[model samples]
Target: MSTPQPPTHQQAAPAPNWQAAPGTSYVSPIPITRTHLGHALASEWTKIKSVRSTMWTLGVFLLLVVGVGLLVAVNTTTEDYTEVPYTIPAFFGLILGQICLITLGVLVVSSEYGTGMIRTTFTASPQRYRVLTAKLIIFFVVAFAVSAFAIGLVGLFTSSLHDGESGTPWGRSVLMGALYVSLLGVLALAVGSMLRHSAGAITTMLGVVLVPAILPAFLMLSDSMRTIGEKMMEYNAPNALARIFELDTDSGTGGSQLALLAGVTAAAIAGAYALLEKRDV
Candidate 1:
């Protein structure tokens, strides 16, 4: 009979309060801090160091720059350098080595796009410009440092081998040469950022670096184009590098070359920033 009478529904006890106690706040175990450029720089440094391409490209670069430079020095007599700076030998190697830097620069940005890692990168760092800036800074520093070291090493070797051959401005030439090559890498990075394709960006940069130099030769064949060809020879990357090392004395100062390249690089970087901001990951 008691079963027949449905048990009265007991009032459900009030759910226990799950909110934080009054005047108390839950603290996350993870530290919360606003990220800045330093964090971005660290991330970029880690990335640049960790990649296999970075190692391979830079290794080849050092090998070409130092190896060829030393080889050239070993083959030459002191008289060979009397008319040119001891550091001029480094120029021969750097002509080939610059390609490595350019390739590395393109890979710095475009590889991420090819591998779909750029999405993750953009997700983690929503401030795209900061990420680009970090890449630029890291790449430039590494490229410049390695370039300077290789060129400097070669210069030291040549100077020791041919001491007192001439009172060349080796120090200034080394600095300017390194700056020129590093700026080329920076420009490649800007192109990479804009193109977002490793092969295409790399190819485009190769054209940028090589085409002008080569086109001038063809243009020189034409009488009317000879002036334009001469202009190209003056401003092209190889000639600029040559001038920076004081190898081309007939031309004007290398300062103009640096300024021109700097302006072009600045413009490309501006374009890269604009596209990065406007485009989707």
Candidate 2:
């Protein structure tokens, strides 16, 4: 009668488990931890190693580097101490094997886009930039370590095989060259991220690495052009690596090429990061 007050039939909300997180207050049976870069790293590592492309590419690369390195060491019977460093043989294998590294680099990012897995990657980690950073870091570390190992093994073999011809700081030489190659791989990853297509990214990177070297060979028509060609030949990634290994005919360039490559790669990666933010999956 007092306006027929509705029955005070009320039920209290269930108490939340203090141990669980906000979103999982009722869903989770156990506690959950916030994700960090370490979690991203683990995810990236799992993705990288689980792919067949990684295994095949790295396997072929190892075969080329070690086999050719050992063969070169076994065949060099004379020591031209004044003309060559014994560690130079490693560069030959690296030159031929680098395509594999570039391929792996492109595949690392572009393959996700190619297969439409990038959506899941982004969905899992909404911070697109963080995912990219993780991929770049994982790719760079794997590349540098593998390249250093191959070069070091070859350098030691060459050092023992042609001890008299070896120059001082062979380890430094090996490491520098490995660093250059790894940088190139990172550049490839940037290209992959920007292009977002496996074949396209791989092809573009191949051109980046190979075209400057190849173009120089065709531009021998005039002195001015030939000079340009010579500069390109001297400054390309492969040539920079050769110089790092002390294989270049002239050491005039020092490490300026590597520094240049690094700068260019940084710019490319920055651009890629911006593009990732602007573009839709």
Candidate 3:
């Protein structure tokens, strides 16, 4: 009884409340928001603008498109524009400038693969198609805008120099030509995505554009291939641009050329999407 009662254990102090007060939920200091295509577009825009290759390629493109166009315009007279739109001179420059765009397009996707940055890109976004869509949209917009500006500037300069040449409408032809070139860049982009190599994709696109123009000449040597050669010339990129610029009326209508390019580009894009989805980084 009285002598040896065990010392009672001291009650443990209540644990401190580390969470937010009652009825109030803890909020993280960092803000969280859902990502979307707009975010991907912004990211792509930043990447494209910050890269040295973008500046270099685009600078050369402008020089070729505008410089050569102005030079051609200066050398020609009003008579030279009589049978073609004022924009036709721009077509000659674009024939070279388009290579710049194709190169840029290939670099856009392939450079990331080369640097192993695509894994980070996919990790950040998780949706491959969204990233591809952003690339296509940004590249197409930039390519089309730059192309149109250069071509249009040359057209206006030529028109002003000539003063009153009767030819096909400059506005429509200039826009169509710009669109066609942009599509070529897009096709190049798809090829880059598929090949995952800048040099290879660029070479492939160069062949796609230039080979059709040149191979048809060789093909014409054989009677069996003469008709095929004519068709190739009619549907080739150079001839398409020529038709659009009214420089070549025998190569088929500009609309048909655009349709052919559009269909081919669509197929290429589909293939790119499939490969991207199925392949591992």
Q: Rank the candidates by lDDT, best first.
A: 1, 3, 2
Model 2, span 157-218: residue lDDT tens: 77676545443567676677777888888999999999998889989989998899889988
- Candidate 1 wrong stretches, greater than 4 Å: 1-29
lDDT tens readout by residue for model 3, 1-281: 56888889898998654545346697544455678999999999999889999999889988998899999989989888777788877888889999999999999999999999999999999999999999999999999999999999999888888775656678988789899999999999999999999989999999999999999999999999999998998898878888898877865559998988999999999999999999999
Weakest lDDT window of 10 consecutive positions for candidate 2: 161-170
Screening candidate 2 with a backbone cut-off below 3 angstroms (N, C-alpha, C), the clashing residue pairs are none
Candidate 3 backbone collisions, by pair? none
Error of 3 at 152 (Å): 0.5
lDDT values of the candidates? 0.91, 0.84, 0.90
- The most accurate candidate by lDDT is 1
Model 2: lDDT of residue 24? 50
Output the lDDT of residue 200, model 2.
91
Q: Could you tell me how far off, in angstroms, the CA of residue 20 lies in candidate 1 after the best superposition?
A: 13
